[model samples]
Target: MKKFFYILLVFTVLSSCSEYQKVLKSEDIATKFKMGEELYNEGKFAKANRLFAQIVPNYRGKPQAEKLMYLYSNSFYEMGDYYVAGYQFERFASSYPNSEKQEEASFLSAKSYSMLSPAYTKDQKQTVEAIEKLQTFINVFPESKYVADANTLVQELDFKLENKAYSIAKQYNLISDYEASIKSFNNFIFDFPGSSLREKALFYRLDSAYKLAMNSVERKKEARLNQAKEFYESFKKAYVNSEFISQADDMAVELNGALENYSTKS
Candidate 1:
């Protein structure tokens, strides 16, 4: 009789639990959403997220689903898992193109990516992605509240990318890879005309060209000395007040002498 009573109690609890779940599901969908909001307000972000997730699939095609998805995205944002949260917010905005929350959703999505962006010298994929996504945000929502901040982020991230490239090009100069060095430095100048390092890049290119021309001799078919003179003259016109002017002039004199001597001997 004791074992029989125990079995009956277990069966009754199981049936009650199943019935409770069904009752919760049967409640007006708006009620479930309210419960979720209440949980979120009470700082039960996890529970609210689960509740919001629960309603979306069952309430699909209903007005509640659209609202629930927006709240669902905010739950993750509130939880501070920005990587996932950003993606979720973007998903909500993309999935519900006609919703009133569209602008808010896009802003939050871009903001979330900006939050996850790492420092410039570290992994920059997130930084790059943030720039691109935020540009899209700006293009889509010209009047968004996040525009000012996103604009700042785009500028900062672009500087970050440019700095990396500029540093690499300068490195070529450090190693005396003169041919490659001049090319890279010229690329930097052309690609980033407004770069703060523009003058420095131009100077390095002149230095590289001078050295390359110094390697020129009577035996080589290539008139590298002439090429070097061209680079020096180009740099001088761009940077007249440059500290390198006097030294560059000296190289030109030396290059002329070397070529003259080589020609006379040949």
Candidate 2:
């Protein structure tokens, strides 16, 4: 029984060594790259990236150069490595500007940046760059098949950038920098009129005006209060059921009560 066990162990070791040596041998790269495409089509992105990376540098300036770069870029995209993928895609676009894949490459490069975009509360360099690149794609390939999707992504990222600016402007109000707060909010509203943040921007606008009105609450600041009223009314007209409606209404009542008391004293 011990001798039989020894024989089984020897066979297992030999089998393992043989398989490892086989893996060490260089594969038929074209066949492997094709297999990678198959796996990529199957959503096996990791394996596809490995195969693609293996081929591109070695196949430089070959017919497969452009194709491998494109496939490699796509692999990064499929694996959700947006930043690297974005760069890879951009490289492909620039390298093969007249290639058949130009439209798709340009669009995908911008798409990669869009995917890398952080939330509304984060840095927006990627968001801004994405917009520029996407618009370039739109301009260059107005009739491309990817136009609609590219436009949609650009719109979405622009909204995020608008929201980020809007929120930062509100922060100034929260900390009582009324002048800067108003400026920030106004900039957000004016620059991105097509933003889906329309109602939200208007709401924050009213809030800024309200905060400005409170700058001198006890010193008969009727002018500021009147400005607040205008903004509040605008907010009400646009977003009647706004969550801030009650607070706005309360401000209105308080201002009216103050005016009435002043009249009584006079």
lDDT for each candidate structure: 0.80, 0.80
Q: Which candidate is the best by TM-score?
A: 2
- Per residue, candidate 2 scores C-alpha lDDT tens digits across 108-224 of 888888887889898898889889988988998899999999899988887888889888988988888876887887898789877777777777777777767666666656776
Quickly count the clashes in candidate 2. 0
Which lDDT value does model 2 have at 189?
76
Please give the lDDT score for candidate 2.
0.80
Poorest 10 consecutive residues of model 2 by lDDT?
17-26
* Per-residue C-alpha lDDT of model 1 across residues 134-243, encoded as one tens digit per residue: 99999988887878988987888778777776777778888988888888887888888888777777777878877877764545524777777777788789888888
| TM-score, every prediction | 0.68, 0.75
Off by over 4 Å in 2: 1-43, 215-223, 233-250, 256-266
Off by over 4 Å in 1: 1-59, 78-80, 115-128, 216-222, 242-266
Summing lDDT over every window of 10 consecutive residues in candidate 1, give the lowest-scoring window.
Answer: 213-222
- Each candidate's number of clashing pairs is 0, 0
